[model samples]
Target: MSDLNARVVIIGAGHAGGTLAALLRQYGHTGPITMVGDEPIAPYQRPPLSKAWLKGEADADSLALKPLEFYAGANIDFRPSVKAVKLERSARRVHLSDGSELGYDFLVIATGARAIALPIPGADLQGVLSLRTAADAEALKAQVGPGKKLAVVGGGYIGLEVAASGRALGAEVVVLEREARLLARVACETLSTFFRDVHEQHGVTFELGASVTGFEGANGHITGVSLADGRIVPCDAAVVGVGVIPNDELAVDSGLETARGVVVDLEARTADPHVFAIGDVAHRPMPIYGRMFRMESVPNALEQAKQAACAITGRPAPAGEVPWQWSDQYDLKLQIAGYAFDVDEIVVRGDPKSGKFAVFHLKGDQLQSVEAINAPPEFMMGRQLIGNRKALDKAKLADPTVSMKEVTA
Candidate 1:
């Protein structure tokens, strides 16, 4: 089949899947494109679901990835409220939940991740929620507002962002974390301290190193959380943001190689050349880090979408971008570039007290990664340095007076 005329089938109508279909069309793919999503609505932005949408600052129309009319106008067949139940790899066919089948010239599995549910008791209570979809956000939004109390389990980005939003809506917010510090798994100690202080100043309570034993409820509604420390945190509602598990059952059932996610290469091609995986469902090569990781971020999704589109449309593979992610809590914007693996030193630029600083992670003077808070220059320059594998003088980098360019020199 000609590259542009090949039929494409994409599963999972999240950010990555939706973006891939759009990118394929932009790359001059005139083939038949069909997308199957379990959600009744089309693909929409998920990041905002925990923040603006939860706080009533963003509406459904504003969060949509693209208008419903765009799909029809682009001649893309978007099947919402349908599930891809089975993947017939040998025959390049997919069995759907609606008693239908689809044959594809190329199969793109973009199935994203799902929120990990709390295993404790009372988890099935009426007011306990986890934010992963628009429906989840709406449910959470309705319960968190003035005169309400919200108990958050976990201190990761999602948990912290939700706490911030809950606080903004005048809801009493208490974050319960088993770790001694917030963002223990993903950020440096200094950055963690800064965020913890910020949240605390905003009147959000923190229960660090607190183990949750179970939840207490009455009449099918959660009322409080039982902690190992012999304390009961009272709340009207609760949100659990422990982490996410990739939706890779179809790949596993179809005999595709799998690990933490469906294993794919830089081009997003699985063991089967005709099959490709992208977004949160893909555990692909990270050349810069010299490893494989299932990156759950918008940038990773967009990059992998381009990678898959280029390969399918006969275009040259695009240059690899440094893996980056961002989070917003209150007025702060945290932008991170690259991974801080095996770091030997960390340098802080600017003042955390002034609400502006960048944390630089270095391995023997080489730029490994950067965590910048409200500091765009540091983020941009540090990202470029990381991509180039540049080394720097620690003193110059730490000096607030030194320009980012001069620090490199």
Candidate 2:
């Protein structure tokens, strides 16, 4: 079949799927493209849903990836509120929930992920929620207001952001993290301490090493949370930000390689030549890290979408950049570049107490990662250093007086 006449079907209309659809057209592919999503709304930004949008600083229209007319104008078949139930790999067809089958020459699975819910009893009670979608954010926003007591059950970026937002809305906020420190899984201890102090100064309480056995509720609504040690934390609402599980059931059911996410090559191709995956759903090999890196960030989604589009169009994948992520809490902006795992030393620049600093994670003078707190120069330079595989002098990097360019040079 000619490339122009080929049919491409994409499942999931989040950042990855939506961006791929647009890029396939932009890359001069005249094929018929269709995108299916379970949500009624079009593809929208998820990052702001937890921060600005939840705080009433941004509106729904601002969250859209593209204007509604863009899809129709581009001749892309966009199906909203539709779910792809099963994948018929052999026949190259997708069975939809609406009793329909869509035939495709190429299929892209970008199912993203779902928030992990607490398995304990009373988790299903009213006032307990997890944020993942637009509906979820709206529900959370309504529950957070003046005088409301909210307990955030996790100390990850999402949980801390929710805590900051709750404080901004005049809600009494308490963050309950089971780990010894905030962001223990993803961040260095230095950065974690900085964020904990910031949250505490904003009137948000933190309970480290606290485990919730279950929730205490009345009549269907949760009134409080019961800790493992028999202590009950009284709250009107709770937001569970434990983590996320990749939505890769379709891939697994179709007999595709699966781990925490769908296994894909560096080019985002699945085990089957015709099948591809991207975004939070694909576990692709990272040459820099020498392992499969499953990144759950917007930058990763955008990069993978472009690579998948190029691969589908018979183009070579571009050189990959260092993975990066960002978060907004209160007036502070945190930008992270590179992975900090297995670092031997951590160097801090500037002052955490002054609310401006950067943490450099190093393995024998080689830059492993950077956590920049309201420091754009550090983030930009740090990303370049990691991408170029450049090592720096620890003393120069830790000195605030030395410019980022000088340190990197």
Candidate 3:
């Protein structure tokens, strides 16, 4: 492809899109590159939006992907607040909401995912909030007033983060979930129990095994949540973070195959040769885990972008480490390093009672992954172990007395 003739257009100014822009420039692809963002601000760290950022402990300045000058200097166009409506793939163009079309030789759909909305009545009330964007953080933060009652409508990471933040702000916080346990979507009962205790210690309350069927409002502002079990969880403000739906509408409408997320090959390329998908919208295959998943973490977004950039630039790329994810709640740092779905055995190292341990998951004798709480060293080594297919003795792995370094060796 001729340098000037080949223009790359990426939808979504997020970690995957922004990092792709930088990678393309670093690899000497001197063609025109433009990043379209639906949000007014450029790409920022999303993990913080649920944790320290919500408590006002962190500022927006530290969440940037690249400085304003960095984008301009690299010859990449940054178009903020642009809504991409339609994909004219046959024309190799994208139709924007502003009645303008942009052409591209190669296109990347990194639109990420949107918060799953509350489906019941009174969902659109004024006091109800969802935390997914910068505007949402600012709005939710403003609502977290002193001595106010905060109701978290989901027990997921986002909901817990908001509950923690609300509790820190001296507001009475309660987490309501339809499931019997918290974080059940991704974690086991043991992990969920650990979190329950941690949150309760921070003055957060949880309504487990309960479902909110509807919201109660007064004058178009939410005031309470109606449970399926015939109870009302009353509050001044409600934060809904049930889950996310992948923003694969563009890919789907553009005739690209999408399942769970945009189904892509190991190279992050969609079935369409001219188009690719990454970040939260990509359901890429993992060779190690032998499964397809869409990971929503900073490392995943960056790694996926790097793989996509390599494929476009004619470089060989490995999937790298097995897919891992993490979340921050209060002072506890939960790091997951592998898939636990098929693991036949789980070994607990360190001490769960001590609130610092690593749950070693293995399929027979082969080490699969490790979920650690406040065990950064074990998490780091586990990442390398899963990537390298490191094996360990089952007996030693479960014994906290044996150093993990020695057991792996």
Candidate 4:
């Protein structure tokens, strides 16, 4: 186990895989590290695809996790545009699409997830797109311009972010959501309302309670979206941001356990001790939440990568931290820390109309989570309180005159 010359193979050169490779080297692992990915490019940041990149504020090179030379200098063999066709667990080898096999002493599955394609008709039209990769963002960007009609399906973070970006590019955006509210899955009603209003103020239209049945098009390009109510929202292009499916087929084929994602223990180890799963493709144990959950965020990927590296190098796992997520929409910055499901009470501080506020979710007096909008101080303090599971008085926490330190103390 102490041998540093062991071969470590990582599937999917994504945030998790790429980060793990760098961390392994940092932790004094002198082994041969190879990262295989289906994409032709190196690991890149995905968050900016719908925000900065689509708005033309950032370029492809800026999205990369590390410079190209970093991988070579660190002796990390990064194989791009190569699909992992099969995983031979018995031989501890991975069969790739290019008719090659890679042997490994340790394997990490960071294949990540893909955008869920709509099963509806006309989804294959030219102008219909989903944002998941660098290429996807580039394609979607071409469709955003002044006077362009862009219809966004679904009301999730991806959909909303793209809508905001489209609006910023002077495109006419209409968001179609089956639910009556925006961000219904993740945010509370108050936070959702705030975002909905903010987007509306930015001239982004929302068609709540609208279900898309199919897309309408001519000459192989999307022209409009047909709703279940027999109405069509005309658009020149459409972006589907419904959700994503974890790329766990290789794990399943290799006889590894799979649920919503590949199931992994606290140390990111899979059913096979030599194999580990991280990032969006891992349903890892969340001890604080008393359950296994998959977090699709940069912080989650980096933290899990560190854990996997430590485990591989015979080091103890890092201390647990509360899960956090953030989103950028025009001028608004939304930051959320911890899970807020099934909270007994919700408290609010600051003024949403003033473009700054924090919504605190509490199970009785215990601080469960915080959704802060342009409120950096609240986010910082709230994250600490959630990590410590500190209970605070609702009155004091909601009072702007009372400082966060006083409330936490």
| TM-score against truth, every candidate | 0.98, 0.98, 0.96, 0.98
Residue-pair clashes, model 4: 0
Total backbone collisions for each predicted model? 0, 0, 0, 0
lDDT, candidate 3, 309-376, per-residue tens: 87777666845756778877777889998777587877887877798998878887777878899999
- Off by more than 4 A, model 4: none
Considering every candidate listed, which one attains the maximal lDDT? 1
* Candidate 2 lDDT, 1-409, residue by residue in tens: 1264579999999999999999898888888999999999889999998888788987667888998789999999999999999999999999999998999999999999999998998999989999999999999999989999999999999999999999999999999999999999988787889899888888999899999999999999999989998999999999999999999999999999999999998778898988999999999887776788788999999999998888877766878989999999988999999898668889999999898999998887678899999999999999898888776988899899988877853
Cα lDDT, all candidates:
0.93, 0.91, 0.84, 0.91
Supply the global lDDT for candidate 2.
0.91
> Candidate 1 residues 234-289, lDDT tens each?
99999999899999999999999999899999899999998999999999998887
**What's the distance in Å from true for residue 95, model 4?**
0.6
lDDT of 1 at 88: 95
Cα lDDT for residue 80, model 1?
94
